[model samples]
Each structure stands twice: as structure tokens, then as C-alpha cells.
Target: MTEKNKTTNNGTSRRDFLKSASMAAAGFMIVPRHVLGGRGFIAPSDMLNVAGIGAGGKGQSDIAAFAKSGKANIAYLCDVDDRRAAASRASFPKAKYIKDWRDLLEKEHKNFDAVSVSTPDHNHAIIAYHAMQLGKHVYVQKPLTHDIWEARLLTEAAKKFKVVTQMGNQGASNDGTRLMAEWYDADLIGDVHTVYCWTNRPVWPQGIQWPTNKSEVPKELDWDLWQGTAPRKEYVDKLVPFNWRGWWDYGTGALGDMGCHLVEAPFRVLGIQYVKDVQASVGSVYVDEFKKGVFPESCPPSSHITLTFPKTNKTKGDVTLHWMDGGIQPERPDELGPSEPWGGEEGNGTLFIGTKGKMFASTYSDAATLLPKERTKDAKAPQKYKRVPGGANGHYAQWVEACIAGYGKMEVSSPFEVAGPLTEALLMANLAVRGHDLKGGALKYTWDNKAMKVTNFDAVNKYVKREYPAGFELKA
Candidate 1:
């Protein structure tokens, strides 16, 4: 457990709030462009002035990468929760802290050259969208957004804004992921078919849960602001700090948590254009007392959902991809081979079965290898595709370099071009869950990438884009 420990790189532990305040007070005066970062001088032109819109867990991780470059000026830190905002200010004393992202956009839009949107899945589009419109380069974290429409809008908006863009699946640029794809392209295994990817999360339900806000609202939390794009609800303590990932209103269930990292490799190397058709079934097998108060009736306490994507005729033949989550697994994943157990307590890692052999990988798309053991060494595959490059300066560093360089080159493996579609497809899984849950029926739809809309299923179609809270429009 990486509980917050109060210590700096120099090993001086923060003994009291007083000591923290005193030390930070001195830090607040220094120009972050120079003093806070301890690296050799970089040309002012090379420094990327960056503002972070969400500075909780992942948000701070992105900031750390930028701070590491010693070439970043953390011009501003923004969070909807006052507690988060205060903690971030204490964490990066050099950064100016703000409450509402809109205030930063309206007043300090030009203060930073690039902005990192690390909010939850639902808000990703709003923050990143508005930032790009202000002409700032943007990086929004993965499961790009909470819904399919948001994903499409983001991809198109980035192109329209012409800003350097990256999704927070940092593994996209890692050496391991590159090797994973290269191995498949090498035909170390024959044509791949069927993928079994799973994660153990969303211990809660999707959609909304209600009356759970009975717990006192923390003085530091701005419940209304935290509900930025989500439907407003009373304050609930358990939902804050953590446990927000399982709710549909704020998150995209299991797919949102692990999809970008797990589903990406198979989609990329295979060059899958679209799922063509998708379906999901969600059911609750646990809970006795009213699971209300924390979550709305629309959500289940725990759910097992399966997603299937039928290969289009354009895909040449049929390729069925299966997703398992909520701590469930196939009876015998071993038929695939010796494997690692996942899904928290009970889930299987991703499986890819090919006509000639099989391959399995952990969540990050690293640890990828062939099946049937001997087929790996004897395999013959074309060696023509140019080798992809490994990530150099961490996630934020790459984006920062692009911001300063004025043009960001594609990293290939997990660039927005690939991550965007994968994210949209996965988000659709959330809609499928809602469809199945509401009517005990399946969701059927057609996707037009050009138009970015579902041809049928209006109920789920309404889900493509959710209503944002007032004044949070993401405009181009």
C-alpha cells in the first residue's frame, strides 16, 4: 500500500503540518522554471509550460514525469475537490493551485503551453476538449473517456485543434508493448483469433447508485464541482478518495480500468478496423442489504460482464474477442497454457489462440510469448516492417518534448490513432451493460467511424454522450 508518506528526496520527513507549511512557503516563491527542478539549464524554447487539470493519483504520476524532465514549469494545478487541490499544492509547492478548471481556462488559458487532463473517464473529454480549443497541447489519460461519443469527439477534436495529443496508456510507448506487437507481426504464431482479456475491478456497479451520500461531506470537498459532468448527488465519503472507478456515471467499469492497457496490443498488431458488432450481459450475484445510499439502483454491487466483437466480413473472416471481468474466468484457461491468475481474486489474463499456436500476455501487453512452446523457435515470419521505437522520456516527457518541438511524431504502438478506437470500442461495453441490465435484452448497433455514431439502439445511443453539468461544455 503506497499510503502517503511525508518525505522528500533528501530524506527529511515532514514531522508536522507546521513544518510542511514552512518549507512549502519558501518553495512557493521560487520560479518553477528554474529552482524546483534540479537539472542543467535548458533553452527557454525547450521548456514546456504545463498545467495539470486533475492531480489525484494518475494526475500526479503524469506531473512527476514532466517534473523529471527538469524542463517543465508546473504553471497551475487544478482539481474539483479542495482537498485534492490542497494536497497537490503541498505536493508540488512550486505549482499554483486552482479549484475549477473553467477558471483556469478562462483566465490562465495561455499561461501554460500544454495541459494534462487526468480526470475520471467522464470528464476527460470536457477538460481535454476545452484545453485543446484554447490552443494548448493536451494529454488525457486512458480509457480516454466514459462513453463512445466522447472518444470519437476527442480523436476528431485533437485533429481539428492540431495540438500534440496523447492518451495516458503510457505502456503504449514501452519496449515490452513494442515487442508484443513485433512478435505477432513476425508470425511467431499463425493468424491470431479470439482474445480473453480480463481485469478484477468495478467491485461496485455501473450507472448511478444513490442515498450512499449519507456520510458527512468533508469540509474540503466541493461535492458539486466533483460532479462536474456527472449527475449531481449528495456527498458520500466512500465514493471519494477512492472507490469511484466502479460507478457508471463516473467510470466505465472493468473495460475503462484495464482496457486501454490490455485490449490495445491485439487490436494494433491485427489492425482490426472495428468490432462490427458487440454485446455484453451484466448481472449481480451478490448483496442482501439495500446496496443503496452509496450507489443508485441502476448499478449492481458486483457484476460479471462479457463483451463479444464479431469480425466484420471486411475483416476477411470471423474473429471473436471475449472480455471477462468481476472476478470470473473460463473453466480452464490452462488449455491456453501455463498462465498467471488475475482479476484481483479470480480472473484470467488475456489469451490469443491462433490456428498454429497461441500467445498470452499480462495486462501491460508485456510478457507476451508464443504457445505450444516449440512453435516459437520454428516459426517463420516476414521481417519487413520497420522496427518501432521505445519510449524515451516517460509519458509526460514525450508530450512535453512534442509541445516544445511544435510537431509530435507518432510513437506507433499506442498513439491516439490506435488508442482512440480501442477506447471507444471498450466504452461501448459499458453501454451494453446498461442495455442488458435495464431490459434483460442485448444491445445491437452499427458503428460508422466517419460519422462516429451508432446506427441503431437509441437507448444506448443516448449513452454515446452524457449531459455535462452546466458551464462545462467542451467546444472546438
Candidate 2:
């Protein structure tokens, strides 16, 4: 038995089968891994060699998880900040380390079979797109890309490149998500028409002006590489590892931070597609004497955005999903005792309203409960969906295994086909948030998903596709 087949435990090696299958099915020569010395090469052992693009924080933990999957070898680690890269470097001591992903992919693409992108939101698309272009599978952090256009581009690129892809929304693989689906399929929650996904995120800063005083760029950091795709700006204090989540240039605000995790369950259970329209109401920050302030560059202090999705196989009509963030939450349903704790300990949760009854789940779709609590106690439904092994934490292994099996050969929970539109929905809601300041506070924005524009508000369309800085075009 080949070493790869031993790990697969299915008697047939994935790559071996994919190689022969490609030739037989295509009836033509499909370049084998051995020929891709300038791209990604599959090892003779069948182990997938992976490169970590932002090897710190979530990136660091992601590599560790991939390494834990036993199917992946962490071959290369790259990050703009050496300080952030330290732990991953220590853990994967044998892996080569680089400071720039562009250099790593350009110089060492041949050594790796896949790339895991866990960079700041603004940089996710550029890195993931390039990796896919090189025929490397990618696992990108949510929300998929910084802007709407990037998400659409990466989604198409995934199909065009024919490489395996997964988003970093681990909850998509959780048992709770499947449980919800089983219940919905069984009519336990009959045709959910509304979903409320809320979070207390922005544990980082938002709704504030950019730091006026530029700080010294850390000696351990490469500011230029970290600023990839976004227009370059002077370095500021403490924005490196986490605070970037709150800035428009660096992050996509709370919706971007938690939307993928919170929204994935509803999107899956209800079979949500691209959003049809959106409207938002955001909390204002006090600026100073006698004025409310709108810091356009930073995410608002809090927001309640309602998104409308076209009906799908699961819904009778349109589906409305409400997203609340920044410590805001929806009214507790009567199903639970007044004293019972809600969604996350941090007051986050997701609720689905259907014709028969309502159901709720905790953050990341954990711990689902039917309305009235008693229904949850008496709930019974055939498990229609197979649980991903290891649930939420299993997401890493799921992607690793899929990459080995080859693209289109395995079912990953949050592939680009799924993550891209999910991301577009969140970014669409953000359009309402950002455009609230424009057109004398327009209350609603009707989206043309086919056109990827706002039909009602022409001014907000500029954000549909942002201009990449010089030398940072989305290329083939």
C-alpha cells in the first residue's frame, strides 16, 4: 500500500485515483504533479505540503491545526511581522520561513500543494487568488475578501483554477449546523423565513478617526507587504495583529469578523443565495461639543442591518436575515426562561423563525434550542446530514483531506462557491452601513446581484469594486 493510501484508509490513494481519473475522464494529458516544478508539486508520499501565508495569531493556530490533521506537512511559513510569526516558526521548526507571501509563492510555490491564508481582511483576496492561480488549493479566513469585487473574483478563480478551496468559518463544519439542517429538513423548523445572527464583536476599536500620529513601523514588521492591495498608509500604533479588524482599509468591521461564523448556519439551513436588498441603522458616536460623529473610515460603534435574500428550495418566500453587532442583540424569544443565558456568553446568538416554530443556536451554531425549550427537550428528527468528523474543530482536517482527494472530488462545508456569496451578502449589508452617510441618509439599498451594483443608489456603487493600488491588480 502506498503511504498516502494508508492515511486515507480507503484502500485507494486519492492522488493516484485523481491522476488516473483525470486522464481517463478528460481523455487528454493533464499535467501531473511531477511536471509542476514551478507551481505546486505533490510529494511521492501523498502528503500535502502546505504554506502558511500569515503565520501568526489565527494563521499560527491554523498551521498548527493543519499540522495536527496528519495529512498535511507545514512546509513554509510567511508573515509580514516576525513577531507574529514567532510561535508558528517555533512549532514548525523544520518549515522554511519568509517575510513576504509574494516572495514565498514566487520562489517556493513548487514546494507546497496548498496555501492557508489568514491575513487581515484587506489582504485575503490577493494572496488566495494568487495561490489558486498557481494551482494550489487555498483555505482563506473569513469573510472571504476585503471588498465585494474581490469575493466575486476569487469565487470565479476557484472554478477556473480547479483547485480545492475552503473558508476559515469553522462553524460551517460543526455538528450543530448539521443538526439545524436536519431539523429544518424534517420540518421541525418549517420553512424558516427569518434569521437573526448577532455578535458582540469589535472587541477591537471602531467608530473612531484614524490615529493622527503615525507611529514607527515595528522593526520586525514589513509594513509594505502587510499593506498589500489596500492603499498604503503610514503605520499606526498597535494595528498589526488584531486591531485591523475595525478599519475600512484593513478590515470589514464586525460583520466581516463574525458574519461568516454567525451567518453560515442560516445560509445553509435556508439555502440562501445572493442578497436582493439591504437596509441598515447604525449607532452614532459622540464626537465632542454638540455633534454626532460619523467616522467613515472606521466601522460604526454598533449596527442593525437587515438583509433580504431571494427564496430558495427551503423557503416559501423571501428570507430576511438580521445582523446585529457591537454588543447589540435582538429581543429574547419567549421560548426560553427569562433567566436563561442566550447564544454566546458574550450575548451573541442566532435565531430562526419558521412557520411551524422557531429555533435558536448559540454562537458558531453551537447548542441549538427549539422554541419553548420543551420542544428542544422533546425534539426528534432523523439525522439527515452526516456530521463532519470532529465538528467545528474538524474544519482544518476536512480541507486537508479534500485537497489530497483533489478538487471536485470531496465535499467541504464552506468551499469558495459557498463562502463567496456568503461574503457578498455580508459586504452587501456593509454597503448600507457605509452608504448611510451618502444620499442624505438613504434608508434602503436595492442590490442587483447579477449586476453586482446598487440600482437605487448610484453613489454607493463606487464601493462595489475598489481600486487596487499600483502593481496590485487582480491578475490571471
Identify the candidate with maximal lDDT: 2
Once fitted onto the true fold, the runs of candidate 1 whose alpha carbons sit more than 4 angstroms away are 1-44, 203-209, 286-316, 331-348, 373-393, 408-413, 443-456
Q: State TM-scores per candidate.
A: 0.80, 0.91
Residue 367 Cα positional deviation in candidate 1, in Å, after optimal superposition: 1.2
Per-residue lDDT of 1-476 in model 1, one digit per residue for the tens? 02244323222323432233324333332133344344443443668878999887778778878878777877789987776666567868877788767667655653567888888777887777767666777888888888777777777777776778888886666554556566676656556667677766556644454543378767776666677678766667677766677677787767787778777766766666555666665554434475523233344433444444556432335677777776655444444445744222334366777765667666565555556545556656555444433353365576666767664554334455666788977876666666664562455545555665566766566777777644444433
The residue-by-residue lDDT of candidate 2 on 25-94, one tens digit each, is 2332234556665434555247778999988889988999998988898889999889999999999988
Candidate 1 lDDT (Cα, whole model)?
0.64
Task: Highest TM-score: give the candidate number.
Answer: 2
Candidate 2: count of backbone clashes, pairs at least 3 residues apart or interchain = 1
Report lDDT per candidate: 0.64, 0.84
